[model samples]
Target: MAVGSVALAGTVSGGEFANPHLCQKGQQLLLYFRTIYGKQILAGYNVYPHTPDDYQQTGRHAAIWGRDIQWLGDVDEVIAHVQRHGYILTLHWHWFFGGDSAWTRERKTPVVLDQLLKPGTPEHDTLMRELSKTADVLEKLQQAGIVVLWRPLHEIDGGWFWWTDLQHPENTAELWRVMFRYFTEERKLNNLIWVYSAGVGDLKKKPPEWRRRFYPGDQYVDIAGIDIYGVDLQQDETPYWDYFRAMEEICPGKTLALCECDAIPNPDKMVAGKTPCWLYALPWWGCPHPRRSVDWARFTMGHPQVITLDELPLFDDASYAPELGILRPADDGGAWFPNSVPVIEGFVAGRGSPVDLLQFLVDDKVVAEIRHPPRDFSWTWPGDLHGTFELTARAYDAAGKQNLSNRIHIAVGVRNAARSRSVRASSGTNPEAAVDGSYYSGWHAAKDAEDAWIEVDLGSPVEISQVNLIWGWKIHPAKFAVEISRSAPDDSERSWETVSLLEDLPWQPWKATHRVRFAPRIARAVRVHAYQRAAHQTWAGYDLAEIEIPIPAR
Candidate 1:
């Protein structure tokens, strides 16, 4: 059983978490973000259809969702369906002031702010009622062992919501503290991960530093985030970069996220702009203008650095087993060139018997063994390495039960065998481009071909273990097979043996590498056969940047 699988009623001790295991899981999730910050980004969205559309287009689900309070009643059902399936959850309330809609700019007033903060006032009573109601909903989740990323009074500096005290904006900070104290001390809702969101005002007028004026201090917040929209989606994203830096300055050491966005930031552009990667992104749903297209969704969701729903680990498992996670060499399929030694770091999580030992394995062979593992342990590759390797960590508890961490694949000291090799295609414009070793060039199949394929002749049978595919910018074929042929290089009707049948390929954006590893085989030729194009593509054929078969060191 998972953490939320069982529901418990009543209060937990000392305002502590109702489910300690679930809290550990939440910490693990935060560690995951911390490890990836400045390195990678997580793909997220808001509400239901966005989730489904993400899955439909990318063959993967968005990692997280910012759920609106408007649909508070269905939250439990939503949690059972999505959260149980590894989707991270956050709640955003568009509070109504005295029953008035949050959208009315006139609802934000100095008089209302004063009344809401002052006791014995009608507005203060209303504030208590609303906060208590929200607390009750959160308590339900706590009872069910679910940890929430709770975001309240978002866009406080935007002057569009009642929570925004435009006349005396400092009152907004006090308001956040009040809710923090109420929910944490009074209601004992310790399952929440508090998020303080700043509004991205007109950069030209207000500038990024304007956000610092409303911060409620670091102690009261867990994550520092911002909501940006209508910003230019260019390679040089100076505005967003400045905003993220400002957030870092204001809430130093806090994880940053795009809590609400009209456009998802591209990981490649973020890296190019020298901007720190966002922990996650939550874009609004179904907006007609600035709407995320299928291709755009595929690009963001499929990027190797972006974490999809399917990539989330099982944090709530209830088995009597220790949980292990890898913390270093973060990107699973990242390639480390020849002679680079990778430092492996990991931890054993949850409540159970202490881990007796930790064994770090490379390709199923134990390379380093720790007799008594600490809360976190480290191991270094003993020598310069070569070949494609699968790395994992196994933890053995005192009683001898063991658990394994998720596996990560990396290549070291390997050269692309398919480069400058003979190539052929059934129907494609530039089939040779796939082996040309150029990121910008690729082979594109003819639209009329029902079963499209491109083959690379290795000149003669050589020992090979893996293939790395760098896909074209806008086109991807989710279903394909990697086959090897031992027949003579000149043979037209070569007998092809399928080594790997991939039905759903991970969303790897343009020039991003997706590796397929298999047992070592002797083959003169290898080919990728495409059965179908991605469902949402208007392009009639498949396309990819390069197909590389890495030759392992002998």
Candidate 2:
């Protein structure tokens, strides 16, 4: 339940805003944008369910409920806030039932839509009960005068969720139809404006018939939308535009939208071309958060054609067209911006390539070149390399044309197991597992062990430059200290010095590799001491996928 701010109000009944009775208020709002598509676009922002009310101060025209709203206990409060703010509410459901049954407790295993769609099964009954409960909540909101843009089972072209099955299109299509019928007809929830959304990949790969394969039908859908991210926005947007064309062919006259995007589309670029007919755009909630820049919001919100909350007409106003004016055609043909540079996607581990390559480079200098390279290859650096380096790849065809890939910047220290003679953990299964150079295997402290340590013997005194630690699947030390010990050969004198102290490390379910570089020092042994585990860890112990200690090549 993410939120955004606006400064306007409106009232309306079904279809008046769009087809005058065929569509609901929410649908009308979408159609209103369609009517003015080429001339104007609407700016929307998502709100987290728990985000403070002041979050609405951003002056966005529309508000989206974050994916987590499906599981939240305070949905009523979220709806009330949207109504109070006079925002056109849109809801995205990231159903968690597919992953964990413990969260819902209605089933013994994860919910499978294919099985649940079949009647008379326990799974089907449980899912229906759960969905009915949600419908009951939305029914109350409708009774209270809230019309929602309901986007469920979104991104069905992606395989990330149970509701999506790109390979089994028929199954996903049936699942969608079942849900739509159950909600619209069986439950009698008419206040919702159904939005049919597919991942950008669906639009890109599927043939023209792909639209028909997953479409529930125009009667069940009011808007055709897609979710896009900016990670590769600059590289290509053909699929984005293709979606608009597909929707026009499949559900002509229905409004098209950028339902979810990490970055807002450039207004000038979007409106310039035979504009792709995007009626509105809703950027995901975190775009303007600490990690992302507010430039996206600033640009879209300031665009002349973008409708902000303050500029929106009352929903029931019949004279809104006079205020908005007619759509205008583009002055010039749109320019296509495509990346001319070679695109690259691959990663290197330590100092080597994980896949075969025609050429490997470090800092734009070709270091290795292979003819008839294998599917995978590795190249050793000048072992003494201890700082950051940029790596790139180049492949050549028989015609001698060169194709370059994106550059990957990586530090060249922390080689695991090479210098480590023996490793010992204070208390754990397979103490030496951390140095085994396998992500699947790791050193695990005893179940009850809170504070733990893993010491590595380098066999002899060496100049240690950096230490890298990879966290395992379950547990990660939130607070830890890396220490170095320099001891005399006779074992008579020893001194331990803290080399690095890390606190408040974030916990992640997947393995994350972190490297810590320090001033070169001479030490016989190095140790990592864990002070605490991240809160999400199921066990009170320390776990590490791998430990690396790289000594400078002398």
Best by TM-score: 1
Q: What is the C-alpha lDDT profile of model 1 across 1-554, one tens digit per residue?
A: 01211212232232222223336556655655666777777777787432233432233456677677756667579656543344677888887756667775555433467778999998889888989988888898777777788889898788777677766777888899889888888888867888888887875575555656677877788787998877654354777778887778877878899998865776677666465578888877422123565456656765776765534545555334555666555431244555566677655642335678888888789978888777666777777556766677888878666767755555677767888899999897898889886544688888666478899999888888788786765567778889999987667887989999887665543334467889999988899988866654544567777887888544
Query: How far is each candidate from the true structure, as Cα RMSD in Å?
Result: 11.9, 18.1
User: Candidates' lDDT values, in order?
Assistant: 0.69, 0.59
Which 10-residue span in candidate 1 carries the lowest summed lDDT?
1-10
Candidate 1 lands at a TM-score of 0.53
Error of 1 at 55 (Å): 2.1
Tell me how candidate 2 scores on lDDT.
0.59
lDDT of 1: 0.69
| lDDT of candidate 2 over 358-450, digit per residue (tens) | 676766888767665432344444544454444556654343434454333344442333223588888978877787655446788987877
Candidate 1 wrong stretches, greater than 4 Å: 1-22, 48-52, 106-111, 208-210, 286-290, 318-554
- Once all C-alphas are superposed, what RMSD does model 1 give against the true structure? 11.9
